[model samples]
Target: MNAALLIGLSLQLSSCSNDFLEEETYGEVKPSEMTQAANVERAIISAYSVLNGQIDGASNAFNSPDSNWSFGDVTSDDCYKGGGGTGDQNNIHQMEIFNANSTTIDIVRKWMALYEGVKRSNEAMRLLNASTDFDPALKLKRAAELRFLRGHYYFELKKIYNRIPYIDETANTVADYAKSNTIFTSEELWGKIEDDFKLAYTDLPEIQTDKGRPTKIAAKAYLVKCYVFEKKWQLAYDASTEIMSSSYGLLSDFQQVFLPENDNNKEIIFAVQHSINDGQASSYNGSIGDRLTAPGGPFYAQYGFHRPSKNLVNAFKTNSVGLPQEDNIDVLNSDKVDPRLDITVGRPGIPYKDLGVLYSTTWARDLATYGEFAPKKRIVSAKSPFYVTVWPYVNALNYYIIRYAEVILWRAEASVEINKLEEARALVNQIRQRASNSTYVKTLDGTANAGNYNISTYTLPWTNSIEATAAVHTETRLELAMEGHRFFNLVRWGEVDSVMKTYLAVEKTRRTHLTNAFFTKGKNEYFPIPQSYIDGFAPGIITQNSGY
Candidate 1:
């Protein structure tokens, strides 16, 4: 295809169309027409565009349309589907109660968006391989990028739905995707994803000229994450060691990592890039999805969703030495807490960004149903330059997929598994120390510290590997709270059933919405594959996950 036509196709892919599994052919520009190097480059850009799935409008509900927030945070113990009530986004409410079925809209939407991403990546590889005229070196680099993206989409699919159709560049028609056993075994699927990342790691450059593009280091980090998920301790450690040797390191201030000015900084290994006032019909380039998570009042009026849960807030409680008070809830109100809690959550008396007063309970739309807390990580201040008045509540802040602190924690986990407890403690300490330095959130008058912030690193030796591993997991939860990693971490560590069941029992007393919540061990681990995928195509071919 010519460059303009290729760009047009990319725009079509990014539209809010719901037709996902169907193949829409652009007038076939044969291999001969795409001989120019620029056309090949445009084709690669088209593949990247699919990363931001369909943007329907400037609605906060679909801001990160393909994100895991609904499943990763709301379904876990960290958050609630904060809105008008259980009737608001009722499908998400079903998911929160562990009752979401295959026909649920959220499941269908997420499934289609991810499959569309897979299709676009496959198309890009097919077009790139067809062209015989582009520079061989450039072709290799583009191929590696596409492979990384394909692996990423599949990884998301594998996590959400254990059995998914693996469509590569060779699957050219709907029939191919409809074939029986298109769903490979779990081991085979992970292997496919691992191979793709390995290729990207070997071929990608150390850095990229553009800010949003992935690098060899990013690929290495992703590979480590893959190994960590599979419990392959030695492989995870080796890959993490390589990433730590790179130029990236933790940002000195933990709060700065989320601010708009510090986007794509040394701390972030890879993130979804966002831009404000891009002149698109909708401000879809910004992170409008999280706009509702901000406190609503005369200051910032918006939909209030994804409110932080009371259980998550309580987990931040720290003791005199700055370690978690795991068994004591009575100590929370009076004892010192982790400094990162003030940065991650908005409580009744903490300052609400640069907008002057302390966040009040009145900010929540229905405090009786959800809670008195708000999410603060992805929110932007009204006075910040990243704030765009055109899309009043929307701000162009990037969402991190992986950061350096996460890499440190992953390395720590791997070390504990490999019997290197001291190394693991040191890695966890690095994250805690940075959080301790991030204790700048104060009262509106700036005269007193917010919520008695206090955090200290692990100084005593771990008694055993189990204790060391538990410490690493708790640190991970504190460091990466509300960033859509909680449920996934729980699942990988085999702690979801116990952790969530207890969470529901305790939280039901505070928030009545979760009174009926229960998490089954085997079935609740992955969401049901959408029923539309089974009924619409290949009736008996696509099997459903258990207890759907």
Candidate 2:
């Protein structure tokens, strides 16, 4: 029997959920038993199905193929780059965003789905532990796979909504509540998350027959991430060093990493696997690329959602010397953009060979008029109601939750914390090298299209180097924005002020473009914990984050 098949065998044993669990199916399992191995294999696919497009439950947000629009719709620092709106003005869904109630819905959906995933994983683990049918060796491997899935899910939950109730076991009753009796403290919970990942690293095979499942390397990469989150810099550096030294170097082409054909590319440390059969196909074109690129066609238009911020589009443009244009240019013009401007955002005139045989750009006038229909960067077409109507790319490209490139960046950032600048620069340059044809350009004057004056200019660290460090950190923010790193990176750096402030300035500067949306400092940083959870658990027991 194939070892890969063995890895998925225990998923077949999931029993039907009772009426209570039924009420909250959340896509983890079906009521009927899956008796056949083929059906069981399908269940494994179903496990991946629950990995939603975005943690926010706003579909197709941040699954952008290219960074086109600013995600300013959510924060004052940014504004909607894409255009188009469903005619249903009565739809309260978009309006409810940022409200305490709306945030609660996102929290509930995320919490429920994560719990469902954990429950399914627990069932698989239990069956693998008790099964006598499979060979002992194969059973152990299967157990590792289930544990990895459970740990990954738990980690994701904890990271997104801190102080969440941790359910590691198969809870058959209310008495089985870990949060009530055996709960780990917030600090201890991080340790538990780390331990599970560590065990997953040990028991899981170094390589797997399946492309989507976690391997030892994926566990290692996540371990590094966990360590960084906890501020364990040396540990993160060590784990990252292992990944860098492993057989997990980047792919030959950076663009291929996001291509449909490159779903499980070598650069991917961990990705929520999506397939065509289970709703993945239903939401294919509504992805980030679709919204960004499909504009101007009868089939698709209303492009410019996730529109690249001048901060980010300018990020990719380099002078002839390889430095970003902002650093050296006297004044940066939006139109006198970088070559990467085409690469990162879909404009009317830019030719994207990767998208199709066509070369096109959507004019500003067209975007202002028809951008409401555009979902740019999302897989969904501009015509669909599910267009980039929400902040972030709401596409179904299966979230690359963690990639080796991020691991590299994390290491660099952590190194900076530990007073290691050269290491940080090297890592940042590694990412730049993949995006550009040449070496790391340090001088700004040589950036592609230097004549454009609208872009900003800041010198790299020549003396104090802190400015350069700040620039590198900003670069990470620009390069990875709305991909879901902006808020967290701000939190991690103790620099949420700058990000929020910068975003507000950008919004104010573009007030005519933004209309009524302006960012406020205290309110937007961390999302308030769900009022429902607080009301259910206890306002005193499970307190909300401050100022929520």
Candidate 3:
């Protein structure tokens, strides 16, 4: 068979069109295709396809007020105020957290998307195991890719539902559901993910790839991140360190990282590819970027759903030069802090000179920006004249899952955990240099006011290995802000309680207009696993998460 023929077989093995398996028989190739390999490889791409739908568009994930302050919907980090309190319905970020009736459709879609990915992957594995017609080397590589994609989908599911019914090739008849065990220990599931990634790293290509496929680098990068999730710090360090030294390096200009022109730029370890021409039509993809970014152009300006918090803005604005904005400043000045602030945060009326767009005060007026003002989170827009349209969806900005900057920080953190403090300090300084525009900032060595604000000294204080592990992880919370890593990172590091008690509770109280109606953090850790899923399966084997 020709290369195209083999590639076609891979497609048949994994393509999204269910007709491939339903209407047609196995081993049958289309007019343009010939080999089983082509169809099988296509199946792998199907698995990759699901990542495009995982993100919540309007107010589900990062766009929620709880995550960002500009939306003004967050009650407390831990609790939802009400379904209609702020812009809860309109707030895409809050929708992901609260599980409202109107927004459950997207959640179901996400669940279905993941299962589709798993089904395609299983079919591919089944074909490979049964066929001797495909080339052994190519077959192994394709299989590895499928496994990686499957594990990735599972990891995403794990995060959202935390103990979703684990399914693999073992799933069979409806009656088989009773015999099947969906209750997998977290450790066991993480083990499966690690193994799949290891196989992927061994088989994937080291060089660059097309828009959607996972390169060797992407697999390795995610492996490090997952390792961090599993508390495998030393291994995470080793994996991230390799990527740091590889061809990947920080882009000289940070702004380019998000530009449409730089969608598949070298610094990106892995990102869900979206095309301007023929992109995924799912709500998660098209037009969301333009909607959030346009501020007030034609596409529609819903209050920039994802706004920066005062705390986050202040954190990024620390003196970049390590020197006070003036002389021996008692408190940190936001005026002369990290330069990335403007790039990350969008304040109303703040014009971004590079992008040639000004933040409009328009989205604030639109109730469509988030959900019904909810007791849980508030959805506030900047107030724009334009109305939110449900047509011709097209999101321009690339949603990055991992980047060179994160990999660098991951390396720096691992270095410290291994007692390589000097190495850790050097990596941390690299980030500071970019953030500060080339100033030597103080190390976290408990030194007295080494940089800008002499008001307080910053040093990591953790008694045990676990606590120290958490502190380094906290750096990730600050460093990787709004890229959708906060809540999950908190859960993984077992620091959710601290974030709730110390940060969320105080932040909520500080912002409340009515002192009597307050939010708390007691019973809001994991979201209620979609009730529908539990009801469907026999014996109702799928149990809800704790405190749901």
lDDT of 1 at 355: 81
Candidate 1, residue 453: the lDDT equals 70
In the range 83-201, model 2's lDDT, one tens digit per residue, is: 44322111211321233332444344445456556666665554445445556675666666666777777776665556666666555454344243125676888887888788888
Candidates by TM-score, descending order: 1, 2, 3
Q: Write the per-residue lDDT of candidate 1 for residues 252-340, one digit (tens) a residue.
A: 99888889889889999987676666654455556655555555765666567888888888788887888887662632446688878
**C-alpha RMSD in Å of predicted model 2 compared with the true structure:** 8.5
Native-referenced Cα lDDT, model 3: 0.50
| TM-score to true structure, per model | 0.92, 0.72, 0.72
The per-model lDDT (C-alpha) reads 0.77, 0.50, 0.50
Off by over 4 Å in 1: 1-11, 15-36, 55-67, 181-183, 328-333, 389-392
Total clashing pairs for each candidate: 1, 68, 75
State residue 4's C-alpha deviation in candidate 1, in Å: 21
Residue-wise C-alpha lDDT for candidate 3, range 1-548, written one tens digit per residue:
13222111223221212122112323364733423666655544555544544322233322221122211123224222222235444333344333233225544545555555566566567666656678988777777777777877777766655666665655444443332235568888888878878888899888633565667888999899788777687998888867877887776665545655566687887765544333233333332322333233323433333333444544543444332232212223335544444455444444433333444444333323221111101111223111124443334344566788888878766776787765665675565555544222332343522233322112443335454444355445444655656666666656666654555444444434222332234434444455555564424566666655
At residue 262, candidate 2 shows an lDDT of 61
List the RMSD of every prediction in angstroms.
4.4, 8.5, 9.2
Question: Which structure is stronger by TM-score: 1 or 3?
Answer: 1
